[model samples]
Target: MCAAYGEERASRTRINPAVLILGFKIHRSLRMQQSNKPEEQSASILRSR
Candidate 1:
C-alpha cells in the first residue's frame, strides 16, 4: 500500500512541474506580445501564481 501510494505521489509531482513549465512558457509568450518589460511581468506572474 505504501509503495503504491508513493508511486501515485511521484507521478502527480512529475506532471505538476511539466504543467507549470508549459503554462509559464505560454504565459510568457503571450505577455511578451503584450508588453515590453518581461522581467517585471514574469516576476508579477510568478508572484500571482
Candidate 2:
C-alpha cells in the first residue's frame, strides 16, 4: 500500500548518511535563519511523528 511505501522511503532516508547529513544541514540553516524556539519546536514535532 501507499503507507507501506511511504514508511519504507522514510526509513531509507533516515538510514542514509548522505541524505541525513543534507537534511540536518538544511535544518541547521533554517534554524540559523529563524530563531532557536522554532527549531526546537520543529525538532520536537519531527520526533513526535
Candidate 3:
C-alpha cells in the first residue's frame, strides 16, 4: 500500500523521487521491525540463559 501510495503521489505531486524512495524504505523497515518483535523476544530469552 505504501509503495502504491508513493507511486500515486509521485505521479500526482512534484515530490522528489529520492524522498519517495526514502519514505518507502523507512515504511518497509518499520513494518519489518513490527514483524520481528516476536523473534527478538525469543532471542532475548535465549541470550539470558
Candidate 4:
C-alpha cells in the first residue's frame, strides 16, 4: 500500500534530470560500479511507510 506509493515516488524522483546527472557523475567516479544510493533512497522511502 504505502510501500508501493513510496516506491513510486522514489522512482519518480530518481528520474529527475538533476538526479540523472548526479547518477552519471557518480557512475563515472565509481568507474561503472552499480549504484546503490537509489536503492537506499527507495528503502528509506519504504521505511517512511
Candidate 5:
C-alpha cells in the first residue's frame, strides 16, 4: 500500500528520484524494525542474564 502510494506520487508529481528512493529505504527500515521488535526483546533479556 505504501509502495502503491509512492508509485502514485511518483507518477503524479515531479519529485526527485533520490528523494523517493530515500523515502522507500526509510520505510523499509521502519518495517524491519517493527518485525524485529520481538526478537530484540528476547535478545535484551538474554543480554541481561
Candidate 6:
C-alpha cells in the first residue's frame, strides 16, 4: 500500500512540472501579446502618418 502511494506521488510529481512549464509559457505569451499591442498600434499610426 505504501509503495502504491509512493508511485502515485512520483507520477504526480513528474506531471506537475510539465504542467507548470506549460502554464508559464502560456502566461508569458499572453503577457507578450498584451505588451506588444501598443507598440504595434504606434507603429501603424506612424506608418499612416
RMSD of every prediction? 12.4, 10.2, 4.7, 13.8, 4.7, 12.3
Number of the top candidate by lDDT?
Answer: 5
lDDT of 5 by residue, 1-49 (tens): 7766777778887889797788789789777777668888798789999
Question: TM-scores, in order shown?
Answer: 0.39, 0.42, 0.43, 0.37, 0.44, 0.42
* Runs of candidate 4 exceeding 4 Å displacement: 1-14, 32-49
The lowest-lDDT stretch of 10 consecutive residues in candidate 3 is 1-10
Better of 1 and 2 by TM-score: 2
Per-residue error at 47 for model 3, in Å? 26
Give the alpha carbon lDDT tens digit for every residue of 1-49 in model 2. 5444544676866477776576667667765655568777798789999
Q: Candidate 4 residues 1-49, lDDT tens each?
A: 5444544665876477775576566557664343357886697689999
Q: Worst ten-residue run, lDDT, model 2?
A: 1-10
Residue 24 CA error for candidate 3 (Å)? 0.5
Instruction: Return the lDDT, model 4, position 29.
Output: 62
Question: Where does candidate 1 clash, by residue pair?
Answer: none
Overlapping backbone residue pairs in candidate 5 total 0
Clashing pairs in 5: none
lDDT of 6 at 3: 41
Candidate 1 residue-wise lDDT, 3-45, digit = tens:
4454566567756777656656766777677675888889789
